[model samples]
Target: MIASPDDVLDALDPEQRQVAEAVDGAVCVLAGAGTGKTRAITHRIAYGVLTGAMQPTQTLAVTFTARAAGEMRGRLRDLGVPGVQARTFHAAALRQLHYFWPKVFAGPPPQLVETKIALVRDAVQHCRLRADRTELRDITSEIEWSKATQTAPDDYPRALLEAGRKPPREAAEIAHVYAAYEKIKSGQGRMDFEDVLLLTIGLLDDRPEVREAVQAQYRHFTVDEYQDVNPLQQRLLDLWADRARSLCVVGDASQTIYSFTGATPAYLLGFRRRHPGARLVELVRDYRSTPQVVGLANRLLAHATGEAAKHRLELISQRGEGPDPRFVEHSDEQAEAESTAKQIRKLIDDGVRPAEIAVLFRTNSQSESYEQALADQSVAYLLKGAERFFERPEVRQAMGFLRAHAISSGSDPEPAHLPAEVRAVLGNTGWSAEPPAGSGQAREKWESVAALLRLAEEFAVKWPDATLRDFTVELAERANAQHAPTVEGVTLASLHAAKGLEWDAVFLVGLNEGMMPIAYADTAAKIEEERRLLYVGVTRAREHLTLSWALSRTPGGRGRNPSRFLDGLRGTGSARPDAFRSPGAGRGPDGTVRPRRKVGPVRCRVCAKALQDAAERKIGRCLDCPSDVDAYLFEQLHQWRLERATEHSQPAFVIFTDATLTAIAEVRPLNERQLAAIPGVSRTKLERFGDDVLALCAGHELAIESDPDEFEGVPEPEIVPDGA
Candidate 1:
């Protein structure tokens, strides 16, 4: 804690001090990663309070996450300013709604539904819709995006079209489900997280007295992570600061990567435009990472295009030089996981704490192999953004049964006997010696129990004479601490979860094309966002950084290329700094070193014009170009797809969307090779439905697929109940 209010200025950098001292007007701070944005903002708020420029009780600081709000509150308290209100948008809105509901008309505020998945399921049933787990999650995500963007159910289809979005299901279906979900919620007198903000906005907008009361209470407002603000949140913020007496927003446009959830940098980027007299501050001094890591991060942004790129901050490292970021290429995912675990083991052996290291990937499914590999190396790890290992149902059951057995034994066991005893106890809780076949809930459950078993093995190795009771006691202490060893373990998280976090050594694995940019990021904006995602990942490393990709998902599969983002940054003869290069960079798929070629814009097949639209490029022609598609063939394929969907108990689009069918009809492919050229014809789908699709195209009877296991199920979107 600072000794006095004046001392706050002493802790800030020149630019940060500028932000802190300018407490009188609308301030827009373009804070880069690791630039002490939080530190600067907190000091500004505290200084405003201690110096008597603003009342702490009247000032409100709103952030996107509860964790961020807590951190802000903690900082403000440490600075000797504690009366300020710091909360998430939902939390703040909920409090206001609860307070004003009785005054407005209601007996009490409606019950808050934390998870919308259950309600969504009910709505799906009401709509007579069918969706699997993945589809449900996708639907839930889409609905969340819709609400965040303030798109109504009736306007959802148009919004999807306008946004150029490829929804999991048809837009009409989703809109129907959304409408049904809302009706159900209203009937139950319940509100979702989005409704919390929506209802609050309604109260403020429609009721002038209520609006005046809120505006009077919170005269000064500070918003953190302004780049991630959506339309709904921005609207609520506007209501809170109706007059804009004093508002300070801090964010980086380059870090605005949550567009899928409807988060945009528009608010932050246009802040000055909204307030012409606003004081703009750019904080580029990065204190978290070393010069080398910072350099790589800047290089990534250098290649980025679009509006976000125009405002991209070139971060300057305050720290001294560190290890150059390493780029590793592996033969397969298994080998990549093993090699990564080996590297992490070496780092741990070399004295880096497990908690200081993180292995981040593009998705959650990528974590399983790494989990197994890390366990093989006896390395402690924790999955971020996932259920706590000890809190898992299987783990809790295992722990309970283990405690019972320990109480009944009434005898001490040698350290070597501990692992076996723990495994036996876990076995009673349906834990198997071998893991399940696939990566699903069953596998996740097994991993949790398996992690416990691994912990026991390590514990025994450390304590030679420990008993089962001692083990349980240690486990209890660890669980209470919220970590395996004093809440310390290597973090395994997705790239999205690793934001706002820094690690001493970061391993960014699975940088393959489809995973990094993601196969679904077909549009220019989405691709640019993917680039920003990598930029965020690169900036997360404080010192050692390893960026790696695997050629194949499994051994002996077709080799794949590294992420396009790494094209100029990896391999020999690359344009990256010499310090960051390995011996053999820019290797082709055949393992031969090749000169890099600049990929030109994709030109249309019919006309030699550069194609811009993703859909146009996908089919190798402009939308306005003449089509060579066989109309009869297209209809036949469509009918066959519909029949196949019914036979498989799946949606028609699951087999192949209309776009893919059209592309196929246009190409009139005679062989599997040509069919594989189509965009949505996944290798798995090709193998399962390829023969049938080809048969239909060739004017032959469709082959019946008898084996259900051979079905490559493509999930259609549906809502996952909130909190599930």
Candidate 2:
């Protein structure tokens, strides 16, 4: 019996139904957060198969992450469309290679080799090169990220080189390592994981007959998170797109954060360019978050620097509200963490699930303080999206030993424990970095790898008859090895890991000046990236988004100020937390963050110097001079400024403006540079007797920190790209 069209329609919301039934041609389901774009795509696949519009084997659904691919497949299976190969690009490539390998390689494909850190150490020792442990560790990490992103050595830019990343030592060096590593493996006849995709793509491209045969097998396609297509992956997608009009895609351009790994949003943004007459559908209602959350997201994008946010279609939320968002300011880091812990504990007591909450921060390093706090509270929580499964010390070691046994044998060792697929991947990156001799720390280094082996051995003893599959399987068990507590609690994760995920409660911690938008956000492009991150953080909360900040790192120093993004939401009289605020702050009119007002200069009483530039300098006393202080020299003024900064834990230049310091050193300005020489004295200042500096000095000239070039007014945020 055929599933009725009405049944399919009933399966989807009205907005989702439009995408599901858009089967006549190319369709772009440009879904924003929380929209049922994934649902619509699933129903579309089910509809196509059930209605006899397409066969199960004829369709493909692709996603950014393997986890997402698994979710999509499960959804399809739930819909009774079991044959649809919803897959990650890599997985899809491997499938193709499995079928086409014989045609391209002329024999059973050579097993790919996995290289471990021990081997690198072996190579280093054999090469007699003296390397520091940190240097060795960084080299391994660099090679891993490079190979993951598929960046070749010659292609690495100058900046990367300066960052201390060297590629393979020599061109032939890595090739030799890889080739020898493979030779040893081929003798054992086992395949590496990446070899699957690399070999598969190689197969389809080399043999036309095989490529066509495989292409004919799957004719329709759907891709989720279409924006993150990398270079090599795009080529495989292009092959399928050639004869398929059943392709459907959904993604958001604003969350294009993986640009570092060669992921590009060009595919999503320029979809129409690829299929000129394609149908485009956008779902604006955000079913994933509360209206207040949605409101904040909208405003954040509205204020964000780039066209991505400024021109985005606002995501309206249908989720219900729960709590008034709070922006707490603490005195220091410990207080920030402790306060957040209190919120988490309270939420759990109120019956919120532990997994339902997330504590997001800017960087992984920031997780330490929160982890400590959570431990202190005896909270059981998981770090979001970490390689909790694969990269754990024990898990990697188990996989390492098995892969090593396979490698040492030079062919398929026919290991019973590892899954056939994982064994394929075991060829590349299976070891630890070795410590150099006499340089010290070799034992420590070897012990770490040994501990990993010990964990693996423990697993093997426990599961005597286990397969390679069991090794990867035990990862989650290993993660929960301590089984610390059974209570549901809060989650701790990075803002980057929180995308496409939702939490009932979210505490966005560390919203301080240097931590949120971050200090490096001086350039226009960087500022926009920071804004996008804030948008991501705000959208992750389904109910409450507690905007927070700390005043300082020291235990009781004046707290570091809130991020500028908090413009009005800190104390009372700011933008009120309301449905009207953009999805980020979603502050009500009253809660809107009022931008901070500038405090102009105060002339120095003893030296007649004005104060420092607000951002780059500090407020300091005049007589705390450096022993080398030359009141007449501007460079000497800088020295004095540094001396003061060292004493006060503030940056240099707080004592005086660079221009003022330069003027002082150049003219030894015992007096103003001919009245105009009063550094930073402008037309207004001059008209107002700016040269009164000498009078304020009482007798001697001291440097001031105020900005000399600040003009008549604060500029308004631009409303549009004038030309565009």
Candidate 3:
């Protein structure tokens, strides 16, 4: 019983209805999270088709991912409208390229390269450079960024510098490698994924007939997640639309998290400026989370500072009151994982379905401990957005053959014979370079294997001396670094991947300072992005939300502080004294009284007075104590080290280990001459940080010391570790 298009408007709220009814001209919908934007857009398409405003075949609905496109098509079908041209930008471009390729020059367009990293590795080798797995990954990202931003190979270095991007490899070397990669790919008559768009654009520009055909076919267009539109995608979109202004785009600028891939919200944000007559609609009512969860999300947005913040639409919760969001603090990561699992179990017993819950983190790396904890508790779980196509079983098997041959070849390998070995491996696996006649899982697998062989050719050129063992090691490292396979159960995903998704209950685990804000987020802009990421995670919950963090990564390790994002939500600048209690302070599982460890306000070692400042308490010293010599200088040095580490994208310990800082504090070196003599103060470091270090020490020396009144009301001193 599919509903007719006329009745589709009934499904939308007033604001959504307004968006859905707009079927003509340029339209921009600034839809906030959980605002029923998907429903509105789908209904708009259905309505337009039913009312004869546009034929189903005349409309092109574009989304960011294949999954998203499938969802849109499904929703449109449910609304009694089908045959709409819904596809990803890449898919749409590829279709046009295929149709127009034979007319231009070639028998067939070069097959799309599926595994880009392998080809990039070949590119690096062609330039006679060696790169580890990490470096290779970085190079791949740089290449993607270069393509998305439309930077030419020769102009990449200057472009990267202008954009303030820091590539792992030298810019000039990357440019050379990119040039070599392009030549090889062209020589082989193949193109990578990005090349699909580049080729399509070129084909349309060079030949007007194809461009006219595409524009005539897709007379009306609608784009989802328009905020994430990259320049390349935008160019294709413009060519397809052909200034008809019949495009309806919907997105939230606040959710623009793909800037790393050159996606920008500028297109979405400046829709009116681009098309002055464009109609605008705003969606703010959140149909997802309860009032309490929405309130916290609003608070998160309140802290955001940027163009997104300026246009931010504070979500108005439509649901009734529910559970207050929980903030739990644990002693370490293991405890956090265990406690999260226990909560999930309790929720299941309380009648929440396992599928209704999700545990989101800032990074995929944080999923391992949670996966273990869930398994230990006999809980069924799933990992969404984790299984990459290249990491699939059949794909990995094909890559394995190439890796084995590469490792066995070692130094002085025969380049001409490598293709034969690759062919032999493919033959053994019942695969061929030509894809199966139709599209399905089997054809996709064959394409993946073909891509691997292409990578092998590149590798042969780059590392003729490399062995199969070396390739295998690199592949294993890559496999280890990849996210787990997606399965059906409780969901686990990174905060980024969790966007455009929702769950009845969400557990945002590992909310510590370094993990949430991530030490690399040194700039004010980067921190804002982190804050936006947290907001994205928060809004993903429809009912219950639990934010938890560990004091340390491991038991008996140095303590960690809660994320600063938790400050306003908790109504405190720091964690409350009772926020995190030791395991011994609470009752055991059997309800027996557990013995407690000594817990109270931390007192200074010299004066025995409760330390008021948290920093002072952590340092375990009173301001007037003799051991506090040059404490100010040490604090300044630590701050400087943190800033320097952020600039260099290194850990604070790497710049100046904690032990080195302590020694400096104790010695209070007054000059570069003395600073150079200190252990851990390498000559290079002295040249870099010596002036600032000595100046701070001199400033501290000018401060009045040895206050006689400091000991007036103090008890006998207790021995404690320096800076405890």
Candidate achieving the largest lDDT: 1
Q: Give the per-residue lDDT digits (tens) of candidate 3, residues 612-710.
A: 432343344555665633455578889988997665444465456554675577567666655654544644456456787878776655552455354
Q: Write the per-residue lDDT of candidate 2 for residues 1-724, one digit (tens) a residue.
A: 2256567778677778888887657888777877877888988888888888889988989887887888888888877788888888867776676566666667766544464454445545544564455345534444444444555644445434443333424434443343443344445666555455556666667778877887788778888888777666777777767767577878887777665455666778788888888988888888888777777667667666665664376897776765556667554565567667767767877888778989998755466456545544446667765523234443456565554554454344455443333434432333343422211123323333433443344344333433444444343333332234434546777788887788888888888886677664555655676767777788778887787676565332343577877774434332253222111122235853422222233333234454332211112213343222234343444555577545433334323345455433333323343434333333323333334433433223322324323322322211111110
- Report the error of model 3 at residue 526, Å: 1.8
Question: lDDT by residue for model 1 over 515-534, one digit each (tens)?
Answer: 78876677899899889988
Rate residue 555 of model 2 by lDDT. Answer: 37
Clashing pairs in 3: 125-462, 406-467, 406-468, 407-467, 407-468, 407-469, 408-468, 410-465, 411-465
Residue 381: error of model 3 in Å?
2.1
What's the ranking of the predictions by TM-score, best on top? 1, 3, 2
For candidate 2, the 10 contiguous residues with the lowest summed lDDT are: 715-724
Q: Name the weakest run of 10 consecutive residues (lDDT summed) in model 3.
A: 715-724
Residue 237 alpha-carbon offset, candidate 3, angstroms: 0.8
Ranking by lDDT: 1, 3, 2
